[model samples]
Target: MAYNPSPKSKAILDQAWDWIQSVEYQVTVRWVFYRLLQDGIYSEKKGYRHLLSLTSKARKGFYADWRPWTLADDTRAPVLVQRQGFYGLHLRGHGFQDEDDWLARIKEEINCPLDRWASQPIYSEIWFEAAAMQGQFLHYANENMPLLAFRGDISIPEKWRSAERLAERYQDLGAPIHIYYFGDYDPKGLLIPASAWRDILAWTIVILNSKGLTKLEALESLNFHR
Candidate 1:
């Protein structure tokens, strides 16, 4: 009596599961549909309609709970007259250092001013076009993996500022930053992958230069949806 994902549905589910496990977050229904189109599982014309049907069927007291999940909000749309499901992701950092030790010892050393950034290892980051994707696509693949990040469809002033500050803090460490982005294929969507990286780099230079950290450059990589 339970719903089993057909081969077609399973293909999309596989991607979602991978993303959810890697990024330690859940995927929104919108994200699922968009990703399906991106992966060529469904044509634009068919993907939207197909996903809508699948999700609708899932909401109608389907046997399989994971077929379509919805967070509980009595006032929210897609009104759930009955039933609920459980999903979880585990993505805690593996750092052994405790907060006390960080403040009492390593904080100053790590935060100290530096002169160059060439010696540091390459850092990689990932961004998704949609903000909701942040949960399942923002973190690193593992604790040892390079840094990963994300932003909403548009820029956020605080997020940018925070990035700038981090860049300044590590200016002398010589780490090169790389970024990977996931998004739609629209005119604006295509530009964001590159633009977001540039904005931070430019801001980093300005802010670090203000602090007298001159003659420093961070190698960076930016790739986005086509």
Candidate 2:
């Protein structure tokens, strides 16, 4: 008979999932676990043990039952594995005119409220070159809803400038300032979200899977243990 995850393991997994979805938390499994352990959300020993056990199960083919993985298979590690399962592998094609054009599209998609005085509009988009695996993102806001913006190939400096300018413009018009990015899954991709939104629109930042339409099904496959 196969060993079942304990209730404690289930609790850890649930907490891990919530952290994974948090805009304030780092998107990597290492960082997530590190922060969780630091916050007393879970003990370091328990967290490490759970990850090790999951890894062992994966190696023995207990999770999938057909193919065995190695202990060195970093991709199967719990938190990072789940993050990859959630965001990686969904490649997106590039289709933005330029930075301004990209920003305009996001504003339109999320409906920026530059004309409003109370709240701002929220908007978000993923930018990537499907063929090359190079990708990035940006976000912006208006008066009514927090408008998230994204650009695939832009630089960090440029992203900052854009966000500042957008905020200034919205504030001048009596609109609330809001903006953020849903970053890519890897380390480099991780920096994009961190740099683009940092303190200005920090509350709105997120890490999202950019793989569009047809790729959604592929995403679903990652959830399957077998």
Per-residue lDDT of model 1, residues 1-226, tens digit only = 1456777776665564554355445445556667667777777755676765565434322424442233121122352343323212223432327778646654455454443334546554455667566566435354433333344333234335545655644654445555566787888877775666555565555556666666344323212222
Q: Among all windows of ten consecutive residues in candidate 2, which has the lowest summed lDDT?
A: 202-211
**TM per model?**
0.36, 0.23
lDDT score at residue 143, model 1, on the 0-100 scale: 40
The candidate that achieves the highest lDDT relative to the unseen native structure: 1
Candidate 2 has a TM-score of 0.23
Q: After superposition, how far is residue 199 of candidate 1 from its true place, in Å?
A: 2.6
**Residue pairs with backbone atoms closer than 3 Å in model 1 (clashes):** 117-174, 118-174
Question: Model 1, 99: alpha-carbon shift in Å?
Answer: 20
Runs of candidate 1 exceeding 4 Å displacement: 1-120, 138-140, 144-151, 213-226
| Candidate 2 displacement at residue 166 in angstroms | 45
